[model samples]
Target chain A: MNGFAIVWQERALFLEGLWNTVSLVVAAIAISVPLSALGAVVLVEAPRPVARLARALIDLTRCVPFLLLAYVIYYGLPQLGLRFDAWWAGLVTMTLYNAAYLAEIFRSAWLALPKEGFEAARAYGFRPATLYRRIVLPQIAYASAPLVGGQIIVMIKDSALLMIITVREISFAANSINANYFTPFAPFVVAIGMYWMLSLIVEAWVRRVASGARLRYG
Target chain B: MTWAAFETLLTGAGTTVALSLAGLAIGVPLGLALALIRWARIPVADQLVATYVSLVRATPLLTFVLFVFFVLPTMGLELDPVPAAIVTLALNTAPFNCEIWRAGLTNFPRDQLEAAEACGMTRTLAFRRIVAPQLWRVCLGPLVSEMTILLKATPAVAVIGVVEITRAASRIGAATYDPLPPFLAATVIYTLLIAVIVQAQRVIEALIARRYGYAAP
Candidate 1:
């Protein structure tokens, strides 16, 4: 197609943007996973007041649209004597927004666990620490894997939103090319393809891990 | 002056809510059709629908909106901006709702459908009487939650120059150079909207439980 020629000429730019997207995703997930785990544990195991506070915070964050949240961090915060570069702003928004969602996913999985197992673990003279260590985390770790992977895919797809913040992610590259060439077909299609492939790869990897966990746990 | 800004934001929020609800109003039935096709396992259509759902699910909504808004005009098929947006959102949601519908369809017992067929009910009739009610009961919760996500995602359409809530907020922020207050107000509207949605889910779930006597967990 005529448009493919334009896209091919822009391959270098596209590849650079792809790299940035991948790097941002990796960093966001690395940070957010632990934060979500902490949030999940707080929602599940903490005292009532602490858990309520955590939930309200999560709910408030989750309800706002991610675009507005990004604008808040990037635009709003700068006026309040805080400024962040586009990359870090994107990273923080991605981490904080999805951590709220992932925490909910993890917390729900934890809640859905059979209470009988925990009770039995307690009945067997297991201390709370050992009971959770030996029993709870393992169960939830596997159960939450597929969901966590799904959320990771969501994060990857959503990273496109960073384009608006000038993050130079793949979508940004595509948008820039469209601006230059006025050919929307090829560049956006390529961006979509890259995203689709990344999601498929993540899906395959998660399937392998989930199956392995099933075999080991079952 | 702030009241006027709030009025603008309120109008935009109405647009946002209207678009999402209209999208779902179309999406729910369209999604069921996709699920039914998949459930019946039609040969070419099964694969076609699968690919459609996968492509839609994997790509970002922004890209999809852009393609609809920009690329479709290139093909000599033009849609006005509002229709284009509704089309984009309805198509965007159909695949997700298809998955949700498929889960309910799959879990529904096969023998009941067969019994309905044996009792001289047509396929459509069977689906209407035997399948639809329970599907609603099974699906209402997840469907409502998905609606909330779609509501939040309404901002993605703003990239195409749709002046929905987030877009309106951005405009106000740009105008006043005080982005925080407008965006914060937008956040409160969204939070309240989502809270109402979640509450409605509870009330409807309770009503369905009472009506149906209980459904499969």
Candidate 2:
């Protein structure tokens, strides 16, 4: 069959894969961003040794390749009698990997905050939680909106690697099509197009958020 | 793990290192050319370069590796796994390095080139003398980070059956039925490799800074 016919015939499979990819990205971001923000706060506010240890752990996580990390979590965990489904493994790996990067981004944003802002909020009788919730956290979110968005884009791209562990994402679907039909070009080209389109949507969305944050905060 | 398994893993790590270096060696020059083409505002070439960079950046490296490994054979251009991995990686990396170089070029002052030209230097010589050194300074940190990324990506080549470090780790784990050891070993190797690159980056940046009579960033 021709490329168009092949794509049309497998439209449902492609759609399923697309849905899986989008959902995986959403799940990963939903979980990881908050963890990263918390880790960033700990890195900045924790005592010296605790912060140092946290920084080292973050560095170690960042150094290891995501694919290897996925393999370890998916296959290695089973051997340790702590098994997870392939999707869970993929989601956990993405969360852990991207959290390290996001933590770094957030930490920098936190450090860049003016010291006087914190003192002023304290002087205005704001409790610690209230100070963070009302003043500090909002500014960090606003300042790091662009970088956090970039990391999310990276998270989207990285989700494709989950296919190797049989998560049946778009790349996996493409591989199956290639193996079944001996048609390498159509499936992969379509997969790449899908990924590119996803990235564009993310980029546009991020730009809008960043501009909004700039206007609101500045 | 036994000495033999450790030896095998080391051999695989060597392949990983070599593949990353080879990819970067070719990709960096290609990236520089792409950056210069865009910098010159060459009408069609600039747009083509933009498309290439964006496409490469947006898609996963795994897809690009798969495409190079599979599609080239259909066009009567067969490549073995190693060559395919290297070619795919260089293709993947060039676009990123191009963007890095472009950023460096953008930050560089335009008047320096004019000054060099006024001093009777040709365009190429002007770039070499006036622009290249500062560009190298600005680009070195990002490029080193990119190299670490390329090194991390070498494992993706294992999909096409190149048997790099990560694949070797998996194989050994399967053989020994102890997945943790082999994978942990691979992690250590990768971390050490990246640490070396980071140290070397510091050294090179310091040397450049000393020569230019400025403190390193």
Candidate 3:
């Protein structure tokens, strides 16, 4: 078979890698967003000690590279006598790292609100929980959606780093294909092209959401 | 894992600092020049610089580092990994710096320029006396933040075989077969280094703001 035919024959394997990438992103973000939102809310409302600790941890996480963090999670966890599969390792690391960033975005959005908005919510006989659920979340979502969209784009790019820990993501699959075919160029080029297409889709979605939020909230 | 191995990793920190500083030295001026070419209505240079910014910003740092370290030599221009990585990192960062600096320049008040012109000041003198000072003051915060990113990005050089702290840790890990201690030690070093850079940038920013009479909101 020709080289192109050989590549075509591996289509299922490559598509599986793409599927893994999508599922990992969806799972990680699905888990992280609510946790991050709660962290952000608590960070803003909690007592001084908890707030200080949360801020410090977030700062440290943001400053470290994701690959290094993944390495720690992937390799360091075994010392505690608990092992994670490569998929779980990637999910955990991505969620933790991106949570730190998203929490900051969330906190900033909350802080930007008019102080009178909170007063008005309290004056309306709404419980704190009901107030936040009804009034605050919608506003924060409108304000923070653009930044959160950027974070999602970043997360997609970062899924490639999972290759270091042997997860069969797009980049990892490409590397393996290159090893078999001895053509590094095609695989890497494909990986880049795939990443670019993903980012463009993300950017378009962000724009649509941002415009919708402006129309609804403004 | 031993104290001796840890000491070797600590020694490599100096090289990381030097490479970062060298990149800053070249990148600042190059970035400023690009910003001016874009802002000053230079015909061909403006479009080219804008495209350069978008392309560089869109691509991953890892790809650029890999290309510099691996691909350039095959095209006949050879550089050691240290220089190659430095070049790539600086080029990767320059676009953002250029755009940020230009934004700072645009933030200057138009009335000041008109006032300088009213005083019969030449354009160069007007920029020197009125615009440049305010630009630097306004630009310092963004510059400090960008510098923090550049410091963080020095680890990327380790990918290209530079024996920076990250590479040193990996080497020690391979030889001793204890990846945790060295990697953890490197992590602590990185954290400490970032803290120091960030605090130093803050101090300098405050001092410059005070000296220049720039008000913070």
What lDDT does each candidate get? 0.89, 0.89, 0.78
Model 3, range B95-150, lDDT digits (tens) per residue?
Answer: 87898878877776888888999999998798778887667667777777788777
User: Pick by lDDT: which candidate is best?
Assistant: 1
Reference A-B contact fraction recovered by candidate 1: 0.73
lDDT of 3 by residue, A24-78 (tens): 9899889889989988977999999999999989988877767778777877677
In terms of DockQ, the best-performing candidate is: 1
Measured against the true structure, the TM-scores of the candidates, in listed sequence, are 0.95, 0.95, 0.88
- CAPRI grade of model 2: medium
Q: How far is B180's C-alpha from truth in model 1 (Å)? A: 1.1
Q: What is each candidate's DockQ, to 2 decimals?
A: 0.79, 0.74, 0.35
lDDT of 1 at A65: 85
Interface RMSD for all numbered candidates: 0.9, 1.0, 2.6
Cα lDDT for residue B89, candidate 1: 89
Best by TM-score: 2
Over 4 Å off, model 2: A216-218, B117-125, B215-217
